[model samples]
Target: MHTTKRLTGAPGIYLLAANALVSTSAYALNTGTDLNLSMKPIAGGMAGAAYTNPQEVSAALFGNPATLTRFKSLHFELGAGLLEPNVDNTQTNDGYSHTSTSAARNYVVPDVAVSGEVLPGFVLAGGIGVDSGIGADYRTSPVNAGAGLGLGGAGAGGAATLPLVLELLSFSGNLGGAWEVTPDLSLGAALTVGFGLGQLGTTGSTTGLQGLSGNFGGTTSSVHNISLRGALGATYKVAPEWTLSTSIKSPLQYDYHSILSTTVNGYEQWQSVKVAQPLEVTWGVATDIVPNLLLEVDVAWKNWSSAALYQDIFQDQFLTMLGGQYTLDAWQFRAGYSYASSLLLNSPNGSLGGLDGVGTLPLNTAVPGVLARNDLTKVVQTTLAPVVWQNTLTVGLGYAFTQHFRLDGFGAYAFSENTSRSTLALGNYQVTASEWAIGAGANFSF
Candidate 1:
């Protein structure tokens, strides 16, 4: 039996701080252009594409609501997972190489849902979960300080030295119903309300600059508002052993606002900004090749072209992001193996850029043109933190201890990928990232 412990006082603060260390980035599961993380261990173990099989109650709320029709008894489920991602960044300028790694090590995600037949042919379900999100926390480094503040080689000391933190959370509530039109056909729809919060913070010390000195800090300028969206899905039993399904999710848009604070000549100042989300669609099929043996596949497309994440980070913002379509999952002995493709866009050199007017300052008369140019380059490179594509593989297992109780667990590993950006001043900027996840959940039915 597993035991649970409650955290209090300093321990709770440490836990919260540990969670906060994870920064927000596109490399996260279902983050950036490809925003789809499996909410259940079975599906997550199957490469985040398990829409055709109605195996868990929570699947109905997150995947295909129509799958709820497959359940004959009332069902309840609750679970949580941890994701560990390691990101490394390296930049070489004038033959000097600087390397840094993300301080974030673990992310905790949880989910809960309940579903049942409300009538002869209809099923109703509701749930709450963390769908997809990203975060990053980098330790203090000379390179980060130099890049963040455009203070390249200014004082013997680098830019204000401190840790950088960024995080984005997407929490959602879902309500939906599924109807079995006939013995072999089902249709489902759901209304999803999402609440997203984005936070960014930076703190550091400054040198003998007369105007700008002391500590620097910032936070979200405004609280995020709840956003509404919808999803539609359909499943067809083509044969006694074959099932096909498809789902489309509307875009979720949130107006993000943030404030950057700093003291200039004994006076404080602040600035603000906004961002938007994207749309997505998924198609899948599952088949029983042999008795008690199943195979599943899924293809998903994300409309990142319309999202602000890519546009703000890359110059080639017109490219629509396409996710792995060849994801394959095979199940036997209540165990499953999965493979998923990458969801990143490969743009040409110089295709990526940074936000405008971020970290800009009046020219320092004391610095020479050469020094000023170098500093500006570092500033732009820092502002436009780079993101790349990655592929993943997963394994999962499900076990039944009794007629009414079941447990499921899974683990996934994302391959490492490196991407580079070339600019007139910064030369080449590169970032590499790799990730993995583990999750478990329990389901009850009677």
Candidate 2:
């Protein structure tokens, strides 16, 4: 007589975990939180918020719209950024480790805005920009696949030959206005509309000893969505040499629908998912300590703990399955520098980032044995998807060729960050991330 033991539970758990990992890993790129790239080259390089300056041009729309009241005439600006990022993942199992690097790619982010006094002490402005964005392309490797399937034990080697690929993109649009209540105080508000898209592909054997392997092999999936949110800000000139400003952004959420299809394997599936853009609050101060030079500083916070999309999906799984928290508060700092033809109105500024991991993952069934027996979580955390928080430094310059024409440029470098997660079941998962960005804009004033 012949008999066989079918490990039904193991493959199901692996597939489910793989699905969740795919979604979460898509957002773990250079930006830290989400796609919060600074649109103005001047302010971006200096890592500063141009909140207190009335002569800041259209870039002011990103900080305190109320600063728009500082503009005395019609202003228009346009610019774009070249962002390059490098991501590397290392997975270890049973004391064996392997590293894989993402393919090189350049992302172009655009910015445009206009502001003018529609009424005395009132400014009307509108613009379109990238609120958040990130993506990575990776080639399939036997080592990575082995790491992903190693949780099923040494016998799972046959399944590790599968090839995988991933890509993601997101952006937003804004419209707003500002009003000066008194010579020293101003208020501003804006609405943001968001959009995102993603794709995942894989190739390999569609079937194996049990049913666990047939679903995803030779499959491709795509997801996209739209969302909305709002922002409010205020600025006050406390003294001729000092200014204070603050801004708050509401949470943005999206319901992405994914459609999966396999041609060579003949399979298809559909899924619905939710993503959150955390709430943010910022405070800033600017001062002129000497002549023709200005300095500015800003502190900002992101409420990641309240990001329902991440908490609901990855948090519970991270805690119950991996014994950790998926959500944590994020903070950012920026300092600015400007040299002008005049006291301060003719100068340029810059800004930077820290602690921003801008993506989401899914939830799989909690199988303690699978997690405890091998470094399955490490593979999921490292090779499949990992979050990295980075620090940045930047510099900017601006020149006014004529009263009506001005140009600004900036360059920034983000320090590399290495992150690792360890579990008794598998071993350790580590990832290193870094990036570089450059931007320039032209402004016309009438």
Instruction: Please count the clashing residue pairs in each candidate, in the order shown.
Output: 11, 25
Question: Can you tell me which runs of candidate 2 are displaced by over 4 Å?
Answer: 1-32, 35-37, 52-55, 140-166, 200-211, 218-220, 259-268, 312-363, 372-387, 424-426
How much is 221 displaced in model 1, in angstroms? 5.6
1-446 per-residue lDDT for model 1 (tens digits): 11212322221222211111111111111234333545475666666656777567777678777777877578888888898777776655445456666676687888788888889899888888877666656535422333223342333332233345556677889998899999999999988898987655453432322222223233223245578889999999999888888888787766554333322233333433344456667777788756555667666665655555444333322212111222223322233333434334443211112222112132111132223222332232232233344466677777777778878887777677776544332334467877778899988898
Off by over 4 Å in 1: 1-39, 142-162, 206-223, 259-273, 314-356, 359-389
Over 220-274, each residue of candidate 2 has an lDDT whose tens digit, in order, gives 4577778899989998888988888888889887665543331112222344445
What C-alpha lDDT do the candidate models reach, one value each? 0.54, 0.53
Superposition-based RMSD of candidate 1 using all C-alpha atoms, in angstroms: 10.3
